[model samples]
Target: MTASSEARETALLAAQAAADKLATDVAIVDVSERLAITDAFVLASAPNERQVQAIVDEVEERLRQHGVKPVRREGVAESRWVLLDFVDVVVHVQHAEERAYYALERLWKDCPTIPFVDRAAPQGDAAAPGTATLSADDIDPASADPTPLAPAPGDGATAGGGPLQDEDPSAPEAAGR
Candidate 1:
C-alpha cells in the first residue's frame, strides 16, 4: 500500500520546514509498503547539533501550525539525531556526522522518494528549491569515505562492522545464577 494523502501532506510539510532551516539532503521516503509504523519518513541533515535542533524545531512548529503534533520525540538531549513521530509520518533530523554514518536513505533505497519544492522559492531558478534534487552527494562529503569505520574504544562491533553502541555504565547488567 502507498502512503495516504494525509501522511504525504504531513511528510511534505515536515520536509519543507526542514528545508527552510537550511537542512541538507532533505527527502521524503515513502515507507508505508515496508513499515506499518508510519507512511513516510522525512530525512534531513544539518552540519552541527545546533542546526539539527533548529530543523527539528521548525518541523515541529510547522506541523503544529497545521494542527498536527508529533505523538513522540526522541534524541533531543544530544541533538545528534532527533525523531519526531507524527503517527502517519516520522521526521528524522540528524547531524551531518550521524547522518553519514547511519545512511537512512541507503537503508530505504528501495522505497520511492517524494519530490519536494519549497513553496517559498521562485520558479525556474537553479538556486530555487524545485530545481534541486536530493542526492547522496548533498548529504555529507564523509559519506563517500572509502575506509571502513572502526569501532570506537570500548564499543562493541556489530556484524555490519559498525560500532554496536557505547556501553552504558548506568544500565544494570543481566542477572547471573
Candidate 2:
C-alpha cells in the first residue's frame, strides 16, 4: 500500500481502538479516493453527552499518543457532535440522538464501507489471560433485522389537515373523543 493509504489505515485503527476502549459504537468509512479533504472517516456514537465527550477525549488522547494530531476540532461545547480532523482522517464522536438527527451514515452512504476484523469477541469458550468473553452476536447488528417504522400519516401537515384545521378545530376534538 502507498504511504498515504498506510497512514490512513493506521489512523482508522487508532480511532477504532480509542472507540473500543470507551465501549462506543463506531464505524469507519473510506472517502479518501473520492473526497478531496480526507481519506477516511471514523464515526462513533455514544449513549449520552458524557459518553460523547469521553469518546472524543479518548480518541484524541490515543491518536496523540501515536504522534498524530488533529488539524482542527469542532462541536465540543455542546458535546452533541465532536469532530477530530487529522488531515488525512476525520473522527466524529456524536451522541446517539445527534447521530440520528445528523445521519452521517446516510450522508456518506455512497462511500464504500470497510469491514474490520471483530476483535471484541472472546477467544474460544475457555477464558484466557486478560481476555474478556463476548458473544459474536453481541456487536453484530447484521445478526438481527432492524425493522423500520413507517412515518405517521400527515405528519408534516397540521393535526387535522392544514390551514383549514383552524377553521374547524372541533373536527379534531370530535375525532379524538
Candidate 3:
C-alpha cells in the first residue's frame, strides 16, 4: 500500500521546513508498504550538529503550526541525529557525517520516494525533473556541497535547493552578482 495523502502532505511540509533551515539531501520515503509503524519518512542532513538541530526545530515548529505534534522525539542531545515521530510521518534530521555513515536511504531503498521542490527557492535551485530520490551510493559525501541549502551554481545538485545549472542566471552562484 502507498502512504495516505495526509502522510504525504505532512512529510512534504516537514521537508520544506528542513529546507528553510538549510538542510541538505532532503528526501521523503514511502515506507507504508515496508513498515507498519509509519507511512512515510522525511530525511535531511546538515553539515554540523547545530544545523541538524536547527533543521529539526524548524520542522517541528512548522508541523506544530499545522496542529500536528510529534508523538515522540529522539536524539536531540547530541544533535547528530534527531527523529520526530508524527505517527503518519517521521522526520529524520541528521548531521552530514551521521547521514553518510548510517545511510538511511539505503536501508529503505526498496521503498518508493516522494518528490520535493522548494517553491521559495530560485528556479535554478530546483532539482532536475525525475531525479529527486538519491541513495547513499548515489552521493559522494566528500564531494557533496557543504554550503547552505541555497546551492551555488558550481556547487552541485541539491535535494530541493541547489544549482540547476551553471549557465542559469537564477542559480545561487549568480545571486551574489
Candidate 4:
C-alpha cells in the first residue's frame, strides 16, 4: 500500500483502540481532499461528561503511544464536546447529548464513513454502507430538545431560554460544527 493509505489505516486503528479503551461509539470519516483541516475525522460519543473526558484521555494516550500528539484541544472544560486536533486525523469525543445535537455523520453525509467496530462486536460485524444500526445505547435522552446545556451558576445564562431562535436542524453546525 502507498504511504498515505498505510497512514490512514494506522490512524483508524489507533482511533479504534482509543474508542475501545473508553467504551465510546466511534466513527471515522475520510475527507482527505475535501477539507483543509485534516484528512480524517474520528468522531466518538460518550454517555456523559465523565465518559467524554475519559474518552478524550484515552484517545490522547493511545495516540501519544504512537508518537502522534494532537496539536490542540478544545472544549475540554465543558466536556460537552472535545476536539483533538492531530495534523492528519482529528478526534471528536462528545457527550451523548452533544453528539445528537451536532450530528457529524449527517454533516459529512457525502463523505465515506469508515466502519467503527466496537470491541464487543463479533468478528466481521464492523459497519458497512447502508447497514449501520443504532442501538438503544447510542441514543441520548437529553438531546430530544434543542436547548443547550444549562451553564453553571455565575455563568449568567438564564434558564428557559429555550432552543436558539436560529437553530437550523438541517445545518451542519447543528450537527456538531
lDDT of each: 0.86, 0.69, 0.86, 0.71
Residue 73 CA displacement from its true place in model 4, Å: 0.6
Candidate 3 local lDDT, 1-177, one digit each (tens): 899999999999999999888788899999999999999999999999889988988999999999999999999999999999999999999999989999999999999999887655555535453235566998976578665455655555654553454358676765765
lDDT of 1 by residue, 1-177 (tens): 899999999999999999899888888999999998889999999999999999999999999999999889999999999999999999999999998999999999999988887776666745766345556757754456655566666655643443334644445541210
How big is the positional error of residue 1 in model 2, measured in Å on the Cα after superposition?
12
What's each prediction's TM-score? 0.70, 0.63, 0.70, 0.64
Give the clash total for candidate 4: 3
Off by over 4 Å in 3: 124-177
Compute the lDDT of residue 78 as modeled in candidate 4.
92
What tens-digit string does per-residue lDDT give for candidate 4 at 27-107?
Answer: 788877678757788888878888888878878887788788878999999998999888778888888888889898889
Candidate 1: stretches off by over 4 Å: 128-177
Cα RMSD (Å) between model 2 and the true structure? 12.5
Model 4 CA deviation exceeding 4 Å by range: 1-3, 124-177
Residue 138 shift from truth in candidate 1, angstroms: 17
Question: Which 10-residue window in model 3 sums to the lowest lDDT?
Answer: 124-133
